[model samples]
Target: MRKNSIKNIRVNEEVHRELSNIIRGEIKDPRINPMTSVVAVEVAPDLKTAKAYISVLGDEQSQKDTLAGLRSAEGFIRVKLAKSINLRNTPEIKFILDQSIEYGVNMSKKIDDVTKDIKED
Candidate 1:
């Protein structure tokens, strides 16, 4: 794997932070649940595109709605992001549903069940 440059990493972090704040505070879309959160962001070295992972603390329907809302507001979000951060070119934002939290919870439960079985034996 190639190592990412310091500048690219920094840009990713700043964008992640700014996006989290904007989604949490500024955007007021009914489809976007209050439990929605920015999980991670991956920016290209050229800063031309960014994939933002968002976690929705709710059912599948909620997650779908949140992603839809973010995708719809992509333009507005990019504009706001560019205004907030001094970048030569604003990266295109793509919203993706992050199910890591749910997967982790499921894994934890499976581990607990296995441990319980081992203890029983």
Candidate 2:
């Protein structure tokens, strides 16, 4: 019931898969960017709450708008997830923006620049 038990891991994966599907196909908010992807999901052992990490591809404005859209549709998303999963109590959906991809890209670029400089030397 704590720290990534088998049951908790299974539940997390289920939530992640179902949420990705719902977000991709069901959400209709214009603010929600088409590039938005559910990268990860962390479901509490009690199943009362879950945090869904989303990666929004695009500029800052687009990412912000997509997050706003997701927050606005949280209730509807929760309902759909509950129905799909057949859970007695649907976990509250909390959307978190995952900026690790961007960070990684930036770091890679920096590394490339450093390597190029080294080669020139």
Candidate 3:
């Protein structure tokens, strides 16, 4: 199957949703911040591997801790995923820390500050 096939897209969405639910409700690791969110999920066409983009709404330490926590819980997460979703092969999840949301917010704040200065001038 092609990379952008309909089936592949559906799988990605299902994996994304299940992952979010598992992380948000199932996991009991204190290292993972309560503000953590799953930004996206990409499952390979073959379903052998997947990448989960995570975002933590906290300091750098919290982000690192969250990533570490997720990595440590990968096996458990995969088991949960397999049980929750009837996939042929449960993909090995690779957690990736995503800072896009934080970056966008920072950029927006900078832009607002510049605009305010312009108005004052």
Candidate 4:
């Protein structure tokens, strides 16, 4: 199996765009934090499953709660996807907590702290 091929990249990009729009504009669950962003989408080669990486722009607890809400609403989301897209089978939707945004924020804070310390010294 070839790795990081053009087809995989295209599919992942398309999935990300569609999922983002659906979650932001279509899904009406209030528990879903409005700050939530669909960061990436990973679809299996067989297209049986899709893991959607989401970044919640808030505290840790808020992120966890939003994920729980999304998980419970998976069936509805899948049905909507089936209706919206032309596919033989709508992939099982899995919501994943993406910590990259948090990580980046933390790293920037650390760097800022170091710079401040150096300036004080």
The TM-score-based order of candidates, best leading, equals: 3, 2, 1, 4
User: Which candidate has the top score in lDDT?
Assistant: 3
Better model by lDDT: candidate 1 vs candidate 4: 1
* Tens digit per residue, CA lDDT, model 3, 53-113: 9999999999999999999999999999999999889999999999999999999999999
Locate the minimum summed-lDDT window of 10 residues in model 3. Answer: 1-10
Worst 10 residues of 1 by lDDT: 1-10
Tens-place lDDT digits, model 4, residues 27-110: 888888999999989888766789999999999889988999899889988887777766666889899999999899999999
TM-score of candidate 2 relative to the true fold: 0.93
| lDDT of predicted model 4 | 0.85
lDDT of 1 by residue, 31-118 (tens): 9999988999998877789999998999999888889999999998998999999998899998888899989998999999999999
Query: What residue runs in model 2 are displaced by over 4 Å at the alpha carbon?
Result: none
Which 10 residues in a row give candidate 2 its minimum summed lDDT?
80-89
What C-alpha lDDT values do all the predictions have? Answer: 0.90, 0.92, 0.95, 0.85
Q: Could you report the Cα RMSD, in angstroms, for every candidate shown?
A: 2.2, 1.2, 0.6, 1.7
Over 1-121, each residue of candidate 2 has an lDDT whose tens digit, in order, gives 8848998898889999999999899999999999889999998878899899999889999999999999999999998998899776799989999999989999999999999999999
TM-score, one value per model:
0.90, 0.93, 0.98, 0.90
Instruction: Enumerate residue pairs that collide in model 3.
Output: none
lDDT measured at residue 110 in model 3 versus the true structure, 0 to 100 = 100
The prediction achieving the highest TM-score against the true structure is: 3
